[model samples]
Target: MHSFFRDSPEFEQRKRRPYSPPKVTLAQVRSAIPKHLFEKNTAKGCFYVARDIVCAVVVYKLGWAIDPFASTFGIVSVAVKWFLWVVYWYAQGIILTGWWCMAHEAGHGTLSNQNWINHVVGFLMHTFLLTPFYAWRVSHHAHHKATMSVERDENYVPRTRKDCGLPDELAAKLSDYHEIFEDAPIYTLLRIAVMQVFGWPMYLFTNAMGSPRHPPYTNHFLPWSSIFKPQHCNYILISDAAIGAMGYVLYLWTCQVGFAYFVKLYLIPFLCVNHWIVMLTYLHHCDPTVPYFRRKQWSFLRGASSTVDRPFLGWAGRFFLHNVSHDHLSHHLFSSIPFYNQPLVTEHIKKVLKENYNYDSTNSFRALYRTFTECCFIEDDGDIVFYKNKNGKTARVLADDALDAPSLH
Candidate 1:
């Protein structure tokens, strides 16, 4: 995608064509990348994990060290304290996010070739963030396999025009949108704010914004929540236990250090991590130009390549965030390729993919705002679908004939 959003009326006339099956196979995609890039370096993975841990500890120490200096200082003491605390929070939060990226790699089996080691590292790192690793791993793996499939992708599935209580027909003119639909900027702001803070937990607890095919109240915690199979039940229980144990540890830490300190040390950073997580995931897949596929129209190649790759936070993002956003397209195609190796893999795959690969360096905040408002509901029909705005205007259009893009489901 050259840009994340489009305002042209020609988009409606020039309906974007659905992807045909890739000219190359998965084996071909694998072959195009250098062999060494695929090597799962256990030592390198551990080193990254250790480095993140050390950074986190340093940030924690720096935060704790701030108070004594603040107290000893003269007139600007309170102001300095507040500013320092903000800096600490920012540093601490980003470092914690680095851990999240490593855990994500572990979940994807990119951390190590040894599956058990991946499990242990992933479980520990995610539990530190209060996430249920195996449970989320199950769905995340599913998402990789079916990235942009409307019925199968694990999260941020779009509602249909009908589902949004809008008419089936595309709006006659984009200009007439105000009278046609409820356009409440304040409500959108309120929704975005809530999602920024609580979206991750809400999704885990209630499967919020998950695929609509799953039953209501489907969750990541329960094995029988429709997201998991009977085989996954034991893993689900283990994840639940890990989360409970982490919660208790936090409680104990609070008791020892005082709740205020606990809040400063952990809770603030945790919230920042959540915000970044939500941003990364949402911006990757939820956009007007991105396509969602039905069974017949979908292939592993199309599903994997359909999403956007963004440069979030620039060099700081690559450093603290493990290049997860920077090389997401290649990551989806080959989840086992670690972030460090993804550049080579990405370049090779981009050659194979040609125009299929998407990289947008649109400022994340701008991209988020555009995506949140402009990418709303898709048409209820079509095997290949693109999002329509709240105004019932589509950024790109596909043929209206049901026969052209017949539902395989």
Candidate 2:
């Protein structure tokens, strides 16, 4: 990979001189989010909590349906029932995702007025999904406070070509995009599912990886950005205990109801929630145009609200993902406004921010696939550059050269 970049003239042209830096300022982006919206509070956060309760009830009902029907069925009928189980699995994913969103609201102190109420709700909701509630809450809030900051961002920092420790075998493999995707997808899934629950704990406990900056705080529930201190540690343990309790209950259910039926009808849907989570954050941050700031250019407001919006998914965004879509800019700004009021205020802020407000109505799934395939690694000049490869089509290489490789991230 180094040889390829070094040998190619285009790489030399695209290689960064010294970083010139971006023109946009933190004050400018902060100014875009209206002050009133930042302060706005709403009861709708309760609606999301209620929705999760309702969705769980519906899922339980569906579980009852699947179990009885599967048991009564013949071999072919059982196969058919299991196939229906896949659909239920998807529904379970959505529901768990919704529950996670509510718990996230609790993290943001949006689900209720009281701080203790938020902690209790978040702990309960996230524990069922095997997520460390306080741990995730702290990291995620840090993500908001430091969104696009390349150095400070909590999640999804894109590694530059120079930074990639690509050995010859891996470099040769990367030469063919297929091998990289094949390798990356496995890691991506593990990251999206296993890492958030398990890896999150290690980061909190050991200060290993994907760890939040440890802020000095006397209170775990109160708003103090940039650190995950000892005070919040108990909440994560509480979350783990809840998971242990749930596991024991599941064991009882398996014994009474039978393991095959238990897994088929109940567990599959529960795991699907991870899909929504993986997709949500991926699409939220991974736009072609989104800038990842270096430390000098980074600031709290710019980092907080630098995220873009997806079209049509707004309600679902708020409901299943907390008010991330609507209240996001304000969430970035204040970090205190509850999720329920986020949307109405976000819209109001958008009206105020106008062109300065970042949003993308473009189809996200298509873009996600394209970027995942094309922009896994970035090439840096003085500025960070994402490039599209030229495959005999008319191309836009920044320096107007037809190099064998085009830069991308």
Candidate 3:
């Protein structure tokens, strides 16, 4: 159909037929692009290697800062070093985010000419993040293959307002919070922070805040039988061990160096990285107008077309999301392409899709605000739902048994 975010005259015509995007054939996609753009070898390798070296240096520097007892001026040197450590922590997030993107490229089998290299890099990157490398690889691969199909889309699937089951009162209440918190910067920040530190762990143990589309698979990372799969649990434990060991060592040094400098320089920046990861993932797929398709009507192309690109953030998106956000449609179209090449391939596809190509270059702040207020706690038609107004009084909408079709318009 037409771009759901905006209402244009062209959108009106598409609305008449409820447009279904054309099937994106491999030949068509390939024919529209230049052959040279698909090459996998180059500067991306150097970048990845540089990141590994930098992460190594940060760890080394932190290790060197462990002076259990030192003079006043010596302590000051330690403080400055710690401040640099914090800066390095922030840099780590950006670096790790890039590494995560690379792993995603591996998921797409795009990191190198060889598929095995992609798997190796993807597994290591995800494992370090305490994610189940193979499992997430499988699920994310499916997500690209079925980007917005309701029955198969992996994450952030939207429901029509009518499908929403909340009674007027409950629906009002849900919408009220949705109004206040859905896109609030503070709220988003808190959610991201909480999720980063605890989200994966919680999702692992409890399956909270995961994609409904995944169903029984939503809890994929959990060890139903054993908790120590190599990439799933063992690697995370190792990571935790490293962090914990460093934290303990830092604590010992703080006895002489002072607590004020320690917290300010190291802990805060460590916290910020979690914030970035959670926020980036949350913002990517949670669009108000993006739809999920059922298997009967779903195709690879329509699912891919469901994604929208953001501007200003697109560069970071490419770096952090493995270029999944920039030319996201191509990602859905061909998950095997490498991250460095996605933009080139995306530009090519845009020409073919023409007006059908969807990109939202709106200010993310405004878009985020709008998304928060208008979009939250959506339900399918025929369910008991609740919402409350500013006064906390309930507003009734539909009964539990009432059957109604979802409204896309």
Candidate 4:
């Protein structure tokens, strides 16, 4: 029976499969990389922050110059003016997002080896964008510490059918076939739009997609929330004060300029920052093939490997977002690695992990649609589980037994 099984076509197919985990330890993976890659150059990191800040300022000024006549073009139609404003918003937003990524690096202590510099730069960049720097830094640390753990991950926790509390009829409509064929494209687009526009704010205010923890509500801005400890209350208050000061500044600016002009210059671009952030994070962790692990099977390596890297808006996207989307796995593995060094580290990771590496080079919009449509709710209880469509069909499941199989090497 063993001989016959070995000779079967199924055995041949299994032998030809490409995906498998690395046989090496995390320390081994680290040892294989060049030691110099870990060295943080404060000057170089500050240069990047300065460059992004200057570019963002230039873009902001350009938009300000164009604002008054933005709607006054006689040769251009209203639609054209609207399109130009959109382009302006997107341009400024992408640059702002780059600043946000720099702050993110600061949070990871990659902006510079100096803790004070990282904190100072991170606080300023994040406050300008209205994000609570310390609050986000602490929570994001939790996210990295518990990436794919269903019980502890800090962001983008998928809901199950039971958790969603969807009525039977509504749940039935979310079935695989209905979502693809029966549901209107407009409905899906609208849902995506809502998520892009309001998801970040909602998460900050209500911790809408955060881990299911005690007290039922976990806000990022609140120190008393379960997301932070009592010791963090002081930093949270500082963050709130920073945000309040920025708001007051904006209010003073708006009082000088018209509210409409302020909205055009600042509010629209700010929304774009939120949109990019939400879309980037949502797509990073929400792939169908990625498994959410329960405590029984959870490990740091496993959790980190569960994230997939995606390309957004092509080269421009990578540039503006500081390769955050493209090299996310590397960032997850070594949070303190600088953005400039991420690509080099990521290549090394891919070489070591080989088939275990997960990268989806799909167009951003298509990937977004695929995740929203297929990667919905997951099973609450599982050693490993893929998300399921509304109809209760498993969207995608990893080959756990095979991944757990003995290393080919």
Model 3, 291-353: lDDT tens digits are 445555455665566566655255655554456556666766666565667777888888777
TM-score winner: 1
Candidate 1 ranges beyond 4 A from true positions: 1-22, 170-182, 398-409
Q: How well is each residue in 1-409 modelled by candidate 4, as lDDT tens digits?
A: 2231122332233224533445666776687678888889999999989889898888777776674565677667566667777888989989998889889999999978899999999999999999999999888999999998888888988886566654443445544435433457798799889999999998888887888774565677778888888999999999999999999999999999989888998999999899999999998898766678777667787778768777676797677788898999888988878889988999999887766577876667767877787776876566777777646666444554634644221
Q: CA shift at 55, candidate 4, in angstroms?
A: 0.8
* lDDT for each candidate structure: 0.81, 0.56, 0.54, 0.79
- Please list all clashing residue pairs in model 4, or write none if there are none: none
What is the C-alpha local distance difference test score of candidate 1? Answer: 0.81
Best by lDDT: 1
- The candidate, 3 or 4, that scores higher on TM-score is 4
Rank candidates by lDDT, best first. Answer: 1, 4, 2, 3
Q: Candidate 3: minimum summed lDDT over ten consecutive residues — where?
A: 400-409
Ranking the candidates on TM-score from highest down gives: 1, 4, 2, 3
Candidate 2 structure, TM-score to reference = 0.69
Per residue, candidate 1 scores C-alpha lDDT tens digits across 1-409 of 4344542332232235543435567788888888888888889988988999999998898889888889777898999998899998888888888888889988888888899988899899999999999999999888887888887888899887667666437444544444444458898788787898899999999888998889897889988888888999999999999999999999998999999899988999999989889989998898777678877788777778877888888888889899889888998888877889987888899898775677766678777877888887777777787787756666655444523533321
TM-score of 4: 0.88
List the candidate 3 regions with Cα displacement exceeding 4 Å.
Answer: 1-27, 42-47, 55-89, 159-165, 168-205, 213-218, 223-271, 312-322, 377-409
